[model samples]
Target: MDLPAPLQWTEHVLFSLLLAVVVRSYVLYGLTGVLKDLVKFLRLLPGVDTLIQFILAREVQTFMNKVSATPVDSEPVKKAVEIPEKGCSAEELLQDMAELKALETVTEDGKVFAYVYTMEDEHAKTLRKAFDMFNDPTGYDGNDKPSARENVVNQFAHTFLHENALSPMVFPALRKMETEVISMVATMLNGDSRCSGSLTTGGTESILMAVKCYRDRARELMPHITEPEIVAPITIHPAFEKAAEYFNLTVCHAPLKPDFTVDLAAFEKLIGKNTVMLAASAPQYPYGIVDPIEDVGRLATKHNLPFHVDGCFGGFMLPWVEKLGYPVPPFDFRVQGVTSVSADVHKYGFGLKGSSVVVYKSSEIRRHQIFAYSSWPGGLFGSPGFSGTRPGANIAASWAALRSLGEDGYMQKAEQLMKTTLAMEEGVDSIQGLSIVGKPAMTAFAIMSTENSGIDILALADAMEARDWHMERQQLPNTLHCTIMPHHIGREMVFINDLTESADEVRGKASLSSKGTAGMYGMVAKIPDRAVVDEFILQFFDKAYKL
Candidate 1:
C-alpha cells in the first residue's frame, strides 16, 4: 500500500472527496425527512381542526375584556330559570322593566340628543293606551278574531306574526301590508301610479335590497360581464359597501365638491357598461348635505342605469319639511330616472324600530326583491325581505305611530324639528372657530372648526358628553354632528351655551384625547394600510360581545 508516496496521496484525496459527497447527501436527506415528520405530527395532533377556533376565542375574549372596561351603560344579564314551584306574575316582569327604565338617564326631559323623540304627556299616554289595547295575545290569530283584528294594531300583528311572508298563500295579509307600505312611500316620493316596491327591516336592509336588485338586473342585461359595479358619492351610507360585499359587486366612490355636494363630473367618468346603479343621498349622514339628485338622476338616465335615492335619514322628514315651506330639493321619485328609494320609518317616521320601505318605479323592478325557495322542504317559501319570522308588534306599533301622527301632526313636529335644527346651526356658526358644513333644511346638521383654530372636535364631543349631551363625531373632515328632534326645540339655548363653553374649554387644552368612535375614527384615518383598519373594525365587533 505504501509503494509510491505521490500515488498514495492522490488516491487518499479521491477517497476524501467521495466521503464528503456521501456525508453531504445524508445530511440533506435527514433534514428533509425530519421536516416531513414534523408536518405529519402536526396534522395528527388531537383536535387540530379547532386550532384556529381556539385562537379566535382567545382573541375575542381579550377584546371583550377591553370593551367591558369602557364606561357605558350595559343591560344586566337575566338568566333564564326552569319553572320553579310556580311562574312569576306578568306584573313582576313589568315592574322589573319599569325599574330598568327608571335607571336609564336618556329618558324624556333628559339632555340626550335624538334617541328619544318625546311628545306631550297627553300624546304619550294616548300611544301607551293604543299599545295596551292592541297588546292582547289574541291579536296574533287573524281568522279567529277578524273583527277584533280590524284595528291597526291587531291588523298589523295579524299581517306579520306567525305569518311568514315567505309563504304568501299561508299569509295574504303580509302581502297586502307590504304592497300598501310600498305604495304609500312611493306616493309620498311622487312616483308614478305604476311604481311599486317591498317592505324591509330598516334603512340598511332597504339599501341592500336596492343594490342587490341592480346587481342582478345588470347581470341579466350583460351576460358576458362577471364584475358589476355601482357609482355613488362618498357620502353614501356604508350599507352600500355591505351590499357590495354580500353580492360581489364593485363600488366607485366619487368625491364631493367644495360645497360638499356630489361631484357630477367625477360620477360621469366613473359610469360604464358594468355600472349597474348610481346612488345619491338625500341629506347624507355625515354633513347632512343633500346630493344634487336631479343632476345625478339626469346622468343615470343618460347612462340607462337605475338611480337610487338614499333618503333613509331624511325621507320621512323631508316630505313634511317641504310641506312646511322648508327649502328642500327634489331627491325622490319626482326626479325622472329615479328608480328606487329607501326610507326609514323608525327615525323621522316616529314609528317603532324594524320598519322601513324600499320603493321602486314598477312591479317588474320590485319583483327582484322577492326571495323564493321552491325546492326546500319548507314548501315554496318566499320572503319579501331578509328575515323569516318578523315581530308583528313592531309592525303594529309602526302602524299605530303613523296613524296617530297623521299629516297634520307630522307637519307640526316637522316645523318644530326644523326650527330647532336651524337655531342650532345658527348658534354653532356664530361661535368663534366654528362653521356649519352646508345648507341643511331638515333636522340634521354638522359643524367643523376653522383652520388652525386648535379646537379638537373629539375633545368638544367628550366635553359635551360630560354635560350629558350625546353629540356624535364624524370623520373625513373631522366634525361634530347633531340630529335635532322636536324635543330639542326649547333646549336650543341650553345646547348653544354648552357648545360655546365646550369649544372654549377644549381649545385651551394642551392635548386632546378621543374616546369611543371618535378615537377609533382618528386611529383609522392615521393607519396607511387599509387591511389594518379592517382588522381594527373586526376587533371592535369582537369587543362588542364582551361580558
Candidate 2:
C-alpha cells in the first residue's frame, strides 16, 4: 500500500496537521464559553463593584503621617502625593469621605452575615469613645518627657503603651494591664500559674507568634532536622498556613471525619519526625464543630509535642457555651498537652477588631517567640513576634471591652446567640431540601443541601442574596456560612423565612440564571488540578488591585 516513500510521509504529516487544527478549534470554542460565563458571573456578584470602589477610592497614607503628628488624627492627610502641595480643607475632606462611604455595599438592615461585626448601638458608641481617647499612643515609645499639649497623650501612653516593656519600673502601669489581660485570659482557658502570653494585633499575629515559637522550639530540640512541619486539621484557619509559609515550615493537613471534625486516628498518623507542633480549632470555622481536642491533646502528650488551641472564632464563647449547659468538650488548656492557646477578644469577645491574646504554658517556651538582637547599631533591640510598633490603642480597647463585658455580659450575649443559632438551625432543617452542616458546637454554623434535593446549594445561596441576605458562600460540600452576632439575635426568623423561600425558588430551577457566584464556585471545584484554580485566584487578585 506504500506508494512512494516521500509521498507516504507527506500524507502522514498532513493528517497530523489536520488533527492539531481540530483540537485547537475545540479548545478555542470551550475557552470562549468559559470566558463568557466567568464574565457574566463576576458582573452579577453583589459587592464586586462596591469592593472595587472601596479598594481604589480609599484614602492613601503618607510617610509624613508616620513620623509627624503625636496623635495623627488632628491633621489628617487625605492621600500621598507625587509632589508637595496644599492639602484639602477639613470640609473638603469630610465631603470626600462621605463619597467613599456612599460606595459601601448597601444590604438589608439586618442581613449581613460577614465582615461587619455589629454591636448594640450603645456598646459601639462606647468603643468609639475608647478609640478616640487613646487613638494615637505609640506602643513602641516610652515618652519620658512631653510638651504641655502632649501631657494627656503621655498619660494614656503611660497607662497602656509598653510594646517591649524595657523595664517594669519604667512602665509598671502598662505592664500591669498587659499582665492582668493575659492572666484573665489564661484563667478562662484553664491555664494555671505556669501560663504566660502576649497581647497581639489580632488572631493572625497571635497564630504567627505561636507557630514561630513552636518552630524555634523544634529547632532547639532537633537541630539536625532541616525542615519542620506543623500538623493541623484541614479546617484550621488559613492564618496557620500563613505562618507556615512565612516561617518556612511545612503544614500537614489531616482530613475531616463525616462529622466535620478532624479524623483523630488520621491526624495522629500525620505526625512524623519532622512534626514540630499540632493545632486544632475549637469549633472550626466552616461548620463550627469542635474537633476532639482532648483526643488530639492526648496524641500531643504521647508524641511529646506542643499543641495549640485556636479558639479565635469561639474562644470567648465556648467557655460561656459550656457554662450555659451545652455539651461542650474539653478544648482549652484543661486538655493535658495544650501548650499554647489563641483567643481573639474581637470576635465573640466583642472587643475592637485588632486585639487577641496568645498564651503559652510557660515563659521558657514563650521566650522562643521573642526576637532580640544586640549587634545592630540600634542598641539592644528586643521585640516579641515581628512588630516594631504595636497598636496600644487596640490593647486599651480590648481591655475596655473585657472589663465592659465582664462574665455576666459575655454569658448574656452567648445565651442570646445560642438561642438564635438554634432557631436558625431548626429553620434550616425544616426546609425541604436543606440541612445544617454539622452538629455545630457554637453559634457559627453552615447550611447545606440533601443528596436527593434537586436544588443546587449555590443557587440557593444566590436566591438568598437576592432577598438581601449576604450569607457567606463556602465549598468542600458547598454551603452558606452564618455567624450569629448580637445584632443577628432577632433576625433568625427573617433568615429562616428568606432561606425557605429561596430554597423553594431554586429547587427546580437549577438551570435558571442567577447562579453567578455559585456557578463560578462549582466550576472551580471541578477542576482537579489546583494550579489552574490558583491561577484563577491570582488573576482575580490582580483585577482586585486595578482601579
Candidate 3:
C-alpha cells in the first residue's frame, strides 16, 4: 500500500484525509454503516491496528475458553488429525470412543428442551429400523446389467435411504415417498387440491425456497421493478434475512405490538411497490405469540401480494390443538391470501430430523422454486431445493410419523402438551419477579422479569443452567424461552420450583463480597456496540470448529 519513494510524504496527507472522511461518516450514520469502511481504510495504520488486533485476540481467546460453553469435542472420535493407516474394526472403534458418547447431552429423560423431538423409545426404534433397512440394500450392483433380485423388493421403500433424490428418474420410490409426504402435509394444513411444494432439509431451507420463489416470480411478473424487498415482522426467523442477503433484496422489519405480535398497521405501511412478498409467523419461536395471520392475510389480499405463513413452530401442533377444543386461530391455507406455508416435521410432527415441507397454493407459483441447468458437461441438472443429495430416510420417516400418529395419536399428545403449556404459563406468571411475556397460543412461551423486579433474569438463567437445564436466552427485555412437549408432562412442577429458586438466588447476589463479572448470559443485551458483539460471536463460531 506504500507509494513511490518520492511520494512517501503525500501518503501521510492522503491517510489524514481518509481518516477525516471515515470519522465524519461514523458520526453521521453510526457504526453499522461505517464500521466495515473504517476497518478497510484504517488497517493501513500499522501501529494503531497492531494494538487493536492484540486486544481483540486476547478478548476472543477469553471469550472462547472462559465465557462460552464447553465445545462438543471431536478428538475422542479420531485417533489422529488424519485417517488412520490401518483402520480398526467397527465394534472396536465404537468401544474405544466412550469420551464422545459421554459428551452428548442426556436428553433421553427429556430434560433438554430444544434440538430434540423424541416421542417414545419404540417410536424412535421404528424410524431407525426403517432407515437401516433401506440404507445400502443389495438391490443395486455396479455391473453391465441390473441385479437379479431387483424385482423382489421393487414395491418396497426400495433402498431409498441410499438413493439420490437429485435424479428422481433413477429412484422412483424416493419420488413416490417424497410426493406422498408433501401431499400429506398439504392436506393437513388444509391446502386445496392445487397445493404443490418440495421437501426441504429443514425449516430454514423451506423459508429460503419460498423467498426465492417470490423473488423470481416478481422478476417475471413485474419486470420493471429493479430492487426487490421483503416485509415481515421483527419476530420472523433469521432465515428470511439470510434469503434477502443472498438474493439482493432489502428486508423491512415491522415492529411489534404490546402483545408481542407484529404491529399490523406498521406492517401494512412498510409494504410499498417494491415489496415482492409478505411473511408472518404462526407462533413465532421467541415468544410463541402467533401474529395476527388473518389480519395480515387481509392486507396481503388488499395489496394483491403473495403472503407466506411460517408455521414451522405451530404447524403440526396447532391443528391438533384446535381439534382439542383450544382457541387456535386460522394461520394456514384455510386462511385467505396465504400463498405459501412452511412447516417443520422435525419439530412437533415427531419425525426424524432435517425434514420439512414448504407448500404453495398452486403448482404455478411453486415452479419458480426449481433450478435447472442445460449446458453443463455433467449432464442435465435440476434440483427442487438447495440440497442435491437428500436423505430419503427423512422423507420416509416423516411419512411414517404422520401415518403412524394419525389424527388419534397426534390429538392425544396435543391435549397433554397443551395442558402442560397452559399449566406452566399459569405457574410461571404467578412467580414474584417473573411473568410470561404474552398470551402464548401454543406449546412454547417466554418468561421475562418484571419492570420493578429486583431479580437479574440472566443470573436466574445461569442458575437454571447450573441445574442441567439448557436455557435458550433471548433479548430485548431479556427473557428465557421454553418449548414444552409431551415429555414435559409431569416435570412442570419441578421446573417451576427450580425457576423460583433461581430467581431467589439472583435477587440475593447483589451483596457479593467482591465484585463479579457481568452475567455472560445477559451481557449481549447490555452491550450498545453491536459491532463488538458481532465480532465476539464471529470468534465464538470460529472456536466451535476447532474442537
Off by over 4 Å in 2: 1-172
> Per-residue lDDT of 285-336 in model 1, one digit per residue for the tens?
8888888899998998898889899999999899889988878889898898
| lDDT (CA) per prediction | 0.71, 0.73, 0.74
Task: Tell me model 3's lDDT, rounded to 2 decimals.
Answer: 0.74
Using lDDT as the measure, the top candidate is: 3
Q: In candidate 2, residue 293 scores what lDDT?
A: 90
Arrange candidates by lDDT, highest first: which order?
A: 3, 2, 1
lDDT of 2 by residue, 226-317 (tens): 88999999999999989999999989999988877788888988999899999999879999999899998999999999999998888899
Native-vs-model 2 lDDT? 0.73
- 1 versus 3: better lDDT goes to: 3
Those runs of model 3 whose alpha carbons end farther than 4 Å from true positions after fitting are 1-159, 511-518
Winner on lDDT between 1 and 2 is 2
- Backbone clashes, each candidate: 1, 0, 0
* Cα misplacement distance, residue 197 of candidate 3 (Å): 0.4
